[model samples]
Target: MRPFQCLIIVALFYCPLSAAIILTPTVMPLNIDKGGFAQFVITNNATATLPLEVSVHQLLFEPDGSYQSATEPAATLMVFPPAAMIHAGQKQAFRVQWSGVSDLPASQSFFVRFAHIQLTPATMPAGLRPSDTGVNIQINYNALLHVYSDRQRADIVLRVDDEGSARLTNLGDRFTYTNRLNFEAIDSEIQSQFETVVGDQFIAPYTTLVVDAGLTLPAGEYHGREIGF
Candidate 1:
């Protein structure tokens, strides 16, 4: 048997024949301000020209692992002209944003996924279909929830001098620091939340943890030290 065949037999995952389609961003688990926007680039590797669809959904996972979901409607972008099309050797970009919906919580974590996408031409002829027709893309983004708290808490407080900074008074009282902190970024067309992990230093419980960068931060109304755990 072929090497790929043997691996497929071992894994029990079927492989498709069409050329693979890939999506990439300069940075993923990409950080954006709560009410901010981010742009992503998508590239096609196949020789045929194709039209595409995109959509996004948000999922809220509680500390206990319970969850809720919000899915968006299907969206078809402007017809990709043949010359302006995503050729086998070319790439294109699209913009995505967080609507600033108040339902998101601060200092929390959730999953964002892409769902319901398929490729088609701006218009297909009556009886012609590309060998690579009907291909689909699915990807997801996993991000953290952030909220800026104004009220004073026993363990948490805002910094006096630094902007967008917070003070953590005592970490041992609430959070058990994890050796590994993992985050994920969602791609709407692919319906998958891909993970990316980063390293962290000491996050003092009572001392301050300054969050200066406006990235995928847990937004709004989190309990003191709840995020530490």
Candidate 2:
């Protein structure tokens, strides 16, 4: 008999192909005025039992339009049942509460990581075993969690360099979410246009997000405009 092997897949966002586990409300918004906490549901769609581990991390962004996750202390946020074993077709409710300072002056962002642990015949329920192929797949998902106060607001500005490269800077006290950017420039009777459609992305406060304008133009000053905030 072949030994069962586990393959792990990590997805920054939700995985559509694997329905073994489903997490609802990929974007969770918590208002400080409304208790600064929220709930998320995880459903097991796989035929076999699933074990899940939950964790939270601080979300950070780089100037080059890239982002990373930083380790967050447990006292900053509270999650109930950080790990659980869920049966097939069963739904589990998880509660997240903010245990940090209650008087937050701005909005904060975090990533909720849900990992589906490896499965084996020994861990499976009675009468359940791996197929003859003896293979199991594990998946990890990262969900966005935003905690904001009443004073949260976004002030975004667009700037274009002499080479026509464009970047967006958020000067406000909170993050700005946008999906599209539109800009046009003119240099000595020559008009250059640039536009890009980026699916949901956020510009954190006091950070610059660089985007590919996809156009090369003569050296000149260009003013960029953002569409559909």
Task: Give the winner by TM-score.
Answer: 2
lDDT values, one for every candidate: 0.32, 0.64
Q: With candidate 1 superimposed using the best TM-score fit, by how many Å does residue 144's alpha carbon deviate from the native?
A: 10
| TM-score for predicted model 2 compared with the true structure | 0.70
lDDT at residue 178 of model 2 (Cα atoms): 49
What tens-digit string does per-residue lDDT give for candidate 1 at 93-164? 655554443332232212222221233443233353445555443323222222222221224322323333
Q: Looking at model 2, report the run of 10 residues with the lowest lDDT sum.
A: 1-10
CA RMSD of each candidate after superposition: 15.6, 7.8
- Residue 93, model 2: lDDT of 84
Clash pairs, model 2 backbone: none
What TM-score does candidate 1 get on C-alpha atoms? 0.38
Best by lDDT: 2
- lDDT against true structure, model 2: 0.64
